[model samples]
Target: MSLIIIGSVAFDAIETPFGKTDKIVGGAATYASLAASYFCKNVKIVGVVGEDFHQNDIDTLNQHGIDTTGLQIKAGEKSFFWSGKYHNDMNSRDTLVTELNVLADFDPILPESYQDCEYLMLGNLAPQTQQTVIKRLKNRPKLIVLDTMNFWMDVALNDLLETLKLVDVLTINDEEARQLSGEYSLVKAAKKILTLGPKYLIIKKGEHGALLFHEDQVFSTPALPLAEVFDPTGAGDTFAGGFIGYLAKVGTINFNNMKNAIVFGSALASFCVEKFGTERIINLTEEEIAARVKEFVKLSSFNIA
Candidate 1:
């Protein structure tokens, strides 16, 4: 099975309760591609960067078996840049700067070769851009997962709602859920969002963990607590990567299968927060991942008598 990820490839300057990074290779696609590559051999990335973006980053993706032919490099302009400062809890951050640069006018052009993808992950982006990618797919993927943020909810709620109709699963944090659904309660928000179109809704609660809701059923997983969280950047995209990558590896999208995907995702994300950017995911060995998954099994496993 082939998986396609469409989102950011940019630079970020971040400050967290743990420490700070002046400039680092980050963004949605970087994290998602790295995490997903651990499980899927054929991961196609679709995004845009500029001259200043490092070529080694492209090589990093390619070395991990992520096809980056779909990634565009705008010759003269600078890449997108974001700066943020996290609060003491590291659960939320305040934006300090947002320079779209080359990404400001991005019109994603998916390569013809990426047309047959079986799983599609649309990471955070403008609603219209995400919708365009979906409409261009020649055949509908088995699962189309979407992630968005409050920025879109504030600026383009109507377009965001329209795009939600095309996805099978939607992943957003608890705050974004409340913003999108205008409901204080997550249960009510999930119920409201499900009616919009997606069959599954994941409400990410950062350090608190994540929750999955399908129909009337719900599953919750806890985030791994670490002594240090060097950088909180890209953790969410890492979660998405692991979640979708596991599903692709198993070649199934059923509810039972998705449960495993969630656990895999949570485990991968746990590794992400331990370091800055994609450092942890890059050099991680398969044996280590297997061991972590076993740990997840132990933490969540229970026998009903």
Candidate 2:
């Protein structure tokens, strides 16, 4: 069994309060697959890039034990590119540019080997694209986690709702949760969203933490406080990658494991923000990852006298 990640794999030019970059390797699958490679050995990516995407970057994924057979590189075309500048707070940003070149007509094609997918991470993309991937799968994965944003809800809501029904887990930020469920109270929002689809809903609260809702149970995972945040570009995708990667490693799916997965995912996300692009996550050691995860444990652990 393998873990499969499906989303955009393209270029990004980011400018933050700390610094700026011209164009670096980015995209949802790029972050998620790299984070997942640290946990799951058999990780594969399904995405489309253009001639502009470098082979060295593709080589990077292969070095991390990620399979790229499913990645389609179109000739005589440019890859999807995005440019954004973050505010002083490092939370809000303004879009400088967005060119959906090869991505405009992406067709998710699965390889025969990927048919044994036990875990699937559908990173943020068009709802119909995410849904198409699910339909193409030979057999239903043991678990399917879908991550989306307010953009989908604003435009392709019907498709997003239909895609929600095909996933076991749904991950969205607090504002998106409110928009999706039309309830201010997260608890109430979660209750209403659960009826639409998804056995579990994770409401991500950027700086504060993340909430996992399943039935009457809710698990809140704390976010690590960082001294400096160089970039926040791919943090959420890294979180989703780390989240699903941990679950695939443990080879189990349940409420208890989901809580722990959130912690593990948050740990990876903390690393993501330490530097731009995949700088921090790419060179992580097992001891370093273990220590980061321990920090989460200590941050949350307490006892009454």
Candidate 3:
């Protein structure tokens, strides 16, 4: 079975307090696929890039054991590119540039081989595009996790709501959760969103950690504190990848399994912020990942009377 991820695979120029970069491989799919590859061996990607996207970049993804058979390369067009600068807080940033070249008209076409998908990670993309991927798949995946943002809620709200009906899990930040549910309290928000669609909801809290909600059950995990956060870009996408990747590896769906998945996801996301773009995650080792996951365990571990 394959763990398929669909989203943007393109270039990014970033400037943080620690350093700056010209153009690096940084997109929702790029980060998520890389994070998932560490846990799920049969990881695949579905995305489009233009002539400007170097072949070396595609090779990099392949080197990580990611199947790029579904990746489309269009000629005579520039790949999607984004540039952003982070503030000292590292949590906030300003978009310096956004060129949605080939991605402007991206029509996700799932290859026949991708029909074996058991786990699907829908990275941040337009609500309509996300819906199209679900409709195109011959068979529904065992697990379908959708990652979205406030942008979609502001523009294509109805489409996003409809897409929610097709996904089993939904991942969004604290702010987005509030915006989507129109409730200030996260508990209330989770209830409202759950009613709308997804059986499970994950509200990402950045440096603070993440929360997992299903029915009347809720699990909260604290974020691993880091000395320095070089670049916050793609951390959420990386988390989503690890979350679904771990789930795919376990080959099961339950509240307990989801809790363990969040720890692995947070561990992967912790590594993502240590450097710019995908620099840190691309070179992670088994030992390093295990150590990080252990650290997460210690953060919330304790004895009860």
lDDT of every predicted structure (CA atoms): 0.92, 0.95, 0.94
**Candidate 1 Cα misplacement greater than 4 A, ranges:** none
Residue 117's lDDT within candidate 1 is 96
lDDT of 2 by residue, 1-305 (tens): 59999999989999998889989999999999999999999999999999989999999999999999999999999999999999999999999999999999999999998999999999999999999999999899999999999999999999999999999999999999999999999999999999988999999998898999999999998899888889999999999999999999999899999999999999999999999998888899889999999999999999999
Instruction: Give candidate 2's error at residue 253 in angstroms.
Output: 0.8
Q: In model 2, what is the error at residue 254, expressed in angstroms?
A: 1.0
Expressed as tens digits, the lDDT of each residue in 138-180 for candidate 3 is: 8889999999999999999999999999999999999999999
Quote the positional error of residue 273 for candidate 3 in Å: 0.6
TM-score: model 2 vs. ground truth: 0.99
lDDT of 2: 0.95
Off by over 4 Å in 2: none
Clashing pairs in 2: none
